[model samples]
Target: MDEGRPIFQQIAERVENDILSGALVEEGQVPSTNEFAMFYRINPATAGKGVNLLVEQGILYKRRGIGMFVATGARERITARRRELFVLEYVAPMLAEAASLGIEPDQLGQLITDQLTAGRLSEKETR
Candidate 1:
């Protein structure tokens, strides 16, 4: 739980992460709001609010008497939305900072590749 963000938003993102990670599949039933509340030690209404956020976004659906389930194409929808956010939140800022530092696009690309290679090497060493 991040103290900087709303608990409901965190709850919603946790579910989204689970779906994206394939831990929650399309049409698979999700835990009830009460279960979420108990697990997170939060109010049931707060948990429901988070779950309802996904429902409103068409990422989840209810089946009358049954519990909530992941919506069809939810993974693709989440991926598309996240990619857009990534560009806006990360890529745009990175480009702005690079420009401010007089780093050309080619230099930035090389820097990124270098960092990726370093990261891979570090991961191998840790294994």
Candidate 2:
């Protein structure tokens, strides 16, 4: 798990990102609390907590006789909600830091391009 913030919150975001990106998807069966806990090597309660956040947001809901499933429109709902976080959590802060350091636009573009290229190359090597 990544550092800072509670692990459960991070797990929640990971699940949300998966849903938004068409990974988990709408009406899909979310991983059981135990499965999530075991997969992430976290406490079952922590996994349950993460899943519960989505339940509250209507991205996920519990079935009476079964486990949790994604809400019918979870993908679209998560996409709209998460867009706000993308700017505030990532882009805005990066821009502020770039301005503070006097990094030019071209420099940022080069950095991103290099990173992406390196990432692709690294993936190819692993494959």
Candidate 3:
């Protein structure tokens, strides 16, 4: 969880992570806002805000009388969204920095490959 962001966002990300990691499958039951509050020691409203974010994103859905459930294709949606975010948030910056440093595109690609081959890059970089 990123402390720099709002707690609600972090909570939403935790749920997304669970979904991405296969801990929360499509159509699977998710804990209620109250349960989330109890488990994370956060206010119920805060937890609800997080859960609601997922609901808004179509990654989760309410069951009226029951609690939430993972929406169909939620994992794929989350993965696609995260990949887009990664490019905008990480890849773009790396490319911009490399350009500023006069690093050619091919050179940067080779550098990335070399790092991967040498196991110098982190897991995220390899990805």
TM-score of each: 0.92, 0.69, 0.91
Please provide, for model 1 over 22-99, each residue's C-alpha lDDT reduced to its tens digit, 9 standing for 90 to 100. 999999999999999999999999999999999999999999898999999999999999999999999999999999
Pairs in clash, predicted candidate 2: none
Give one clash count per candidate, in the order shown.
0, 0, 0
Model 2, range 40-114, lDDT digits (tens) per residue?
999999999999998999989999879989999888888787789889999899988998999988999899999
lDDT of 3 by residue, 1-127 (tens): 4678899999999999999999998999999999999999998999999999999999999999988999999999999999999999999999999999999999999999998877854765869
Better of 1 and 3 by TM-score: 1
TM-score order, best first, reads: 1, 3, 2
Shift of residue 26 alpha carbon in model 3, Å: 0.7
Alpha-carbon deviation at 40 in model 3, angstroms: 0.6
Query: What value of lDDT does candidate 2 attain over all alpha carbons?
Result: 0.90
Worst 10 residues of 1 by lDDT: 1-10
Instruction: Supply the TM-score for candidate 2.
Output: 0.69
> Which clashing pairs does model 3 show?
none
